[model samples]
Target: MLAEADNGAELAASMAELKAYLRIESDGEDAVLAGLLRSAAALCEQFVGQWLIRRGARETVPADGRWHRLAARPVVAIGAVAAVDDAGAVTPLPVEAYAIDIDASGDGWVRAVRPGNRLAVEYQAGMATDLNGVAEPLRQGIMRLAAEHFVARGDEGAAPPAVVSALWRPWRRMRLS
Candidate 1:
């Protein structure tokens, strides 16, 4: 199973930024705004197909001597790679036993020196290591989207404005089906 290990402390759009965007001056709606910001960040990630905040993740895959692509983009580092047995036991592989490669587009790839049935790889990936590192357009999109969500609170079915997509389009990863 692959799962995110950490989401980091900084949000793509901070509460203060969102509040300022919405012209909200009171703290009464802080909790609601926080949720909206998180939701907006998540939506941005989904649209871009990348993590906006740096975080760790683990994924298990068949180690068949073929390059296996990591799930997250713009991988920052590979922490560990281990072989997993049918009994669910994990044995860490030596650094020399595998190779890690990241493409120009920031996609990470891994392959074992020797073929094995399965392996688990732990790594970090994201578009930015911190909130400030995120692109301006992405941050702005998050703020705008959250503000839109706040204003349209009861209209969950409404589509996000085209500007959100426009702002995020450049960062969107294109996957060939």
Candidate 2:
């Protein structure tokens, strides 16, 4: 099992970082609300990584691969430099990454946002299937994390699937370039 303190700290830190980023990144939008969505997305990433680790994953190697936050946004850091391939002797899985796209409404959506400079490189995976599989569970996980944060901060109202789904509908249909 994941150490509650460690996972909890990661969750808290990711949420705080996301809120800060949105406050700075949001252009004339409600920074508070945008921050909330960002926080939710970041928390979900943390949850995915922490859950995998808690399940006794030995490595998130390429071929096997791993999704992690090297920097910014969703801050779930998983795996190690060993996943990197030195040459054809080993092919490294380009690190998978996470992104959440929230519509102007409060619905949450997600995508892979792994970074790279080479135009040819891509982190290909069964994103649609992964999304479908994770959607409901992640919503619940976000609700759990949000509940924890809200209680600690004395905030009100946990996000519901109905509200999240409604807000997310638009972003869920969004296409990436």
Scored by TM-score, the top model is 1
Candidate 1 structure lDDT:
0.86
lDDT of 2: 0.34
lDDT of 2 by residue, 77-105 (tens): 23322222444342333334434333332
Model 1 regions more than 4 Å off:
6-8
TM-score per candidate: 0.94, 0.26
For candidate 1, write residues 70-156 as lDDT tens digits.
988878888899998889899999999888888888888999889988889999999887667899999889889989989988986
The root-mean-square deviation over C-alpha atoms between each candidate and the true structure, in angstroms, is: 1.5, 15.0
CA lDDT, every model vs. true structure: 0.86, 0.34
Which candidate gets the maximum lDDT versus the true structure? 1
Q: How far is candidate 1 from the true structure (C-alpha RMSD, Å)?
A: 1.5
Ten residues in a row with the worst lDDT in model 1?
Answer: 5-14
